[model samples]
Target: MDYYLLPIIAIVLGFLFLILAFYLALSNARRITKLGFINLILIAVVAIACGLLLMFVFTGDLANFV
Candidate 1:
């Protein structure tokens, strides 16, 4: 359970970021910079998720596989 904590925390944080980004995008629909902000957040979530997954996968922990 302890071994999974980091990735789980990361995923939860990523979801929060997604929700915030969506709200921002929705609230700024008339702005020309809307898409760029949303895209940046989306990219950030993907990158963070990937990095966390990789870290867990490469740890060689057979009992707690990602």
Candidate 2:
């Protein structure tokens, strides 16, 4: 395994999750609950934070991919 792989993977996967969450947020479903939206927001936030932290640990250079 490489030092860059884990954070890279986390960032890519996190982006995908973020996209999905945004899609869900954009969709209008009459029966959808507020809790579901909250969960999605949380997931997106945490995934993004986790990825960024990992990147920071591995690269120590923010705003650029590790």
Candidate 3:
């Protein structure tokens, strides 16, 4: 029931999703280009969201993970 756990989970899930997106983009398919483009957007959004969550967790009072 730690306060920081939620953000940490979010960050991990984002990374996993990113990996899946990459796999999709790299797979041999007719729409590889479209998948790659979508993956790019997914990467950007996940990165930004995780980064902001980390910053908020550490900079804000929720950093009290102890």
Of the candidates shown, which would achieve the greatest lDDT relative to the real structure?
2
lDDT of 2 at 29: 63
Every model's TM-score: 0.52, 0.66, 0.54
lDDT of each: 0.68, 0.73, 0.69
Please tell me which model should have the higher TM-score, number 1 or number 2: 2
lDDT of 2 by residue, 1-66 (tens): 886787777777777877776777678664446787777677777877887888787778654652
Residues 1-66 of candidate 3: C-alpha lDDT, one tens digit per residue: 865566667666677766666776677555457857587658757765976777687777777883
**For candidate 3, what is the lDDT?**
0.69
C-alpha lDDT (0 to 100) for residue 10 of candidate 2: 74
Which pairs of residues collide in candidate 3?
Answer: none
Compared with the true structure, model 1 gives a TM-score of 0.52
Model 2 residue runs over 4 Å out of place are: 61-66
Candidate 1 least-lDDT 10 residues: 57-66
Number of clashing residue pairs, candidate 2 = 0
Flag clash pairs in model 2: none
